[model samples]
Target: MTSNTILQNATETTISGDAQVINAGRDVNMVHGPPAGLSQLLRPVSNATYTRSGPVAKCDPGTRVEVINMIRNWLNRRDKQSVCWLNGPAGYGKSALSQTIAERYANKGRLLGSFFFLRGAGDRSHIARLIPTLAHQISISVPVTKRLIGRALEEDCTMLDSSASIVHQFQRLIANPLSSPLNLFSFFAKSKILVIDGLDECDDKVQMAEFIEMLIDMSQRDQLPCRIFLTSRVEEHIRKKFGDARAQSVLYCIDLAAFDARPDIQLYFEQEFGHIYDQNLPIMRRIPQPWPSSQALSVLLDKAGSSFMFAATLVRLVGEDSMPSKVLQEVLDSGSNGLDPLYKQVLSSASPTPAFHRVIGTIMILLTNQSIESLSLLLDIQAGEIVFELLKVQSIVKIPGDDNKPIMLYHTSLRDFLTTKS
Candidate 1:
């Protein structure tokens, strides 16, 4: 099927509030409930039905069509590589595209699993949870594997434990189950895929390297049943690992920076601005038909510099503020270039102080994620005060309703901005 057709179906499903798509050829529907013991350990992304906290970002339809079609074609091809690595710099929309692909395959009962590595999101940001999470999702989606995974867990209770080697987890919880006779016979999909987004975001560098090596090993040996789709910023270690001679045969790589994204950015800005204009029609009635003039859009597009995050952040800022025109002007007027000026604008609006710096700084440099309550105790500040400070920068910072949930930046660029030496 064409990418546009797939997107149209997905859009219809989303609009109906029913995430399920008609299982065209599958014997059984993808399981909803998590597999037994491993259920608690899985850290799946927030998509369609699976419930992980925090907001999920998806590619805006009509945008990213070329990349989407390329990935879809890769997934559907018969004699394709087992692993596809889509890498780009931050804010280039890697995660958004991953989310889009996952949702598309998931609706078709072909997605085995997906894990989006979110920094400051507890287990979601760690590699230790990755294999187990994929195992759990696989079991639930492929029923035959559920029993096999359970049996494996029963035999080696430590298979899912953090102390266990990643190789052990992959072998026992994932490879063994899916490759088993019963599973291979029962789970008869042409393509079963696992989407891993933001691998660079995972906190454990050692584990991340080990996991990539393990994937290469498995792919080389043809031991895994599902194709692996991964998206991440182009970190040195990851690039080096994937660049290994051994990986060349089975690994397909795409760099987002190579694409001319100006057209896509234009489409996104047009649609988003149109939405904003429609929503605030009464207030915006006086504005011209093309509310944001072509000249204004060209300026914003040039500033975007192949970064979707910049475009998206600009849209969020303008849409949320009462004075949309003013927000757009301020963003254009910022003297500095790239995401820094925008980041600075957002940070400055929060009215930074020693206390604010202490709060946000602690979040940025945290070795691991912490909840507001825990952060309060660690910093010796009241939880309410932390919330008050975060409120000013709600556009960039995400403050969860529950104090126990981790506070997170909408994008990692905020931390980069804060840490970069002036």
Candidate 2:
């Protein structure tokens, strides 16, 4: 199908919240899901829903359309050899954009599968979890392979057998099914895109680099029809790997920072506030107020420093507790250092006692980027005790999941602000 037609049909299908079913040819029919397993798999373990709610800010619709068009083109192209790298700093909405595109294609009966790598979530860090998650996402039965993989595990397994170094295993598992003539094109036809987000956040940078190389190899060989769309911070290791010869001609790299941000940021915040006001406080609804008042938004825009997380956090913090007037005053007075006001608000809400502060300070100093268990040892405190204390103030401290390892700040800005203070 043409890209435009695919987009239109996809949008229409989504309006009714039903999957588009297509009969390719003969008696062979491909039905997209009313209850797609892939959609359920993409959801974060904590939150099953796909939509993000926040204040509405201006988003460059033109840019968004361009991105969507590019991805749609890649998926529609018969060559099936391209890989798209969408790189951006934390909180730049790269994942959100990709997710939206995946959903649109899935609705249109174009997408085969997708995976979201959530940082600090247990499944995100380990290769064992990552591979199985992706396999499940594609609705490929994995019982036999899962049993083989499980049996390979040993308490004293060498590096080759360890769960952490499962790159070869993943490549084999994904590639073997498509190696056969009968299943090659059929398998590829079923999966139009392989969406992977937050490559930099994966704990083992080395393994992530290997996985990217393997993907590059697979794309070059044209062994599968799937195009990989990866979103990450442009970390050094990833840049080097993508710079390799295999990626030179086939890869399309788009930097998130290069895009104009003013519109999208404005749209995001505006939408968020509008939703809350309309749905929660119908009586208080009025003509949409121009948020950030140009002057205030300019300050927020400047202070955000190209980080959407910073901007969103500030908006949420100020809007939740204070009036518009107060929020504006706080932003203006704080000037370029608006982060402090947000941080302070979070801190105050945390209500950290002298002991809590000491514990936090110690963790901040001794294990600036280490996991929670490491912090527990440095503090000479039980891991559970530390976790309980941190969870009480999670909004400020950024506690990781129970199944996950350590907790940290939602952003580096929080860690920087906390550690630098006397």
Candidate 3:
């Protein structure tokens, strides 16, 4: 027999002659499935777009431009290594700004990976889940590690398995992949950027701290060509862990509150309201008014307090009704005390049961400014169910558009009201 026939026969024999019988006279292509464990490794990662519209009033343009330039410079610069830690108070636009940067890099196919830590979201707080999530994004496949992960999954295990430390798993399975010569990092002397947001939201603060320490160590040791961009509210533990002067020097720390991007926020609102008005009021033939005239926008900006979430939420709430003028009037009239009342009004309008007040109360008490999943799980309810109820009062709670993370109160003012009332 010729080598080709012999090879075909051997292939048929491997399948116990089943293939030979099935394809009696037809040419059969011998196919090898992807490497063992590759099935799990090849699952598509998310690169969802997170959109926000308004004049970008919440962040200062000059500051944002400076930050963007810094990041771009870091990416392009050779012989200089850098990390960036973006810190801010809760409700500030740190995550949004990080997302914006990630989106920009993605457009150029230069983004390595990005992970958003949603506290209370199942398993997300653990390094095991975080590493795999990021590796999937970079299309780095580790078959052996995947098998281990699969085995853990089959046993119905939590990421914090007694068998292995999450940090070790991350070092071996995830971080090591980027160090390989065949990987993308070989072509670029500078590492690809990895964005991790909401560090304060991670449930296990100690473990998160350890992860950060390990990352710093790895970066210093040059184990991998990777730089990290992290965003979070300034939690005491995190601040202490990363606040060392030496670490700070190696890492660029930007306070999101320093940015004055009110124009962006206003433009965002105008676009959102403009779209809604055009779609719903086409028959009325009303020419879209220039939104939030300079003075009116300034008033909204004063209320925004450098929080993108707050600005976005207010725009959504005010834009819901056709009477923008009346909405603006009521908001302005409420002054500083009016924000909470607006939230309460929105909540009271949507909730059907008197029990909802208790529910709202419970949510406020449980708020970690992290994932809504934990809250839902704690209440023994489905996330979708809670979200459906919350949507009715969208003016008060803002659900992120991309993922099923917990709903966030539109502003610090809303959270303050809920906490104070409780």
1-422: candidate 1 lDDT, tens digit per residue: 21112433233333243233324333323323333355654443432123454676788878889899888888887653888999998999998898888889889988888888877666777777777777778878888887788777667756666699988888887777777777654345437788888989888888898889888988888776677898888788888899899999888888899999999999999999999999988778888879689987888889998999888888887887777877888887776557778877877777887778899889888866678999899999999999988887777877889998778788987887877788
Each candidate's number of clashing pairs is 0, 25, 26
Taking every candidate in turn, the Cα RMSD to the unseen true structure, in Å, is: 13.2, 14.7, 9.3
- Give the lDDT of residue 305 in candidate 2: 61
What number of backbone clashes does candidate 3 have, counting pairs of residues 3 or more apart or in separate chains? 26
Comparison by TM-score, 1 against 2, better one: 1
In terms of TM-score, which candidate is strongest? 1
- In terms of lDDT, the best-performing candidate is 1
Candidate 3 deviant stretches above 4 angstroms: 1-36, 39-63, 140-163, 182-191, 276-291, 337-345, 348-352, 358-391, 398-422
The digit string of per-residue lDDT tens for model 3 on 358-413 reads 44666566635444575566676666666666667767666665334555554445
Ordered list by lDDT, greatest first: 1, 3, 2
Off by over 4 Å in 2: 1-63, 109-111, 140-167, 184-191, 274-291, 322-324, 337-345, 348-351, 355-422
User: Against the hidden reference, what TM-scores do the models get?
Assistant: 0.84, 0.65, 0.70
For candidate 1, the 10 contiguous residues with the lowest summed lDDT are 1-10
What TM-score does prediction 2 earn? 0.65
Candidate 1: which stretches are off by over 4 Å? 1-51, 184-190, 281-283, 353-355, 376-385
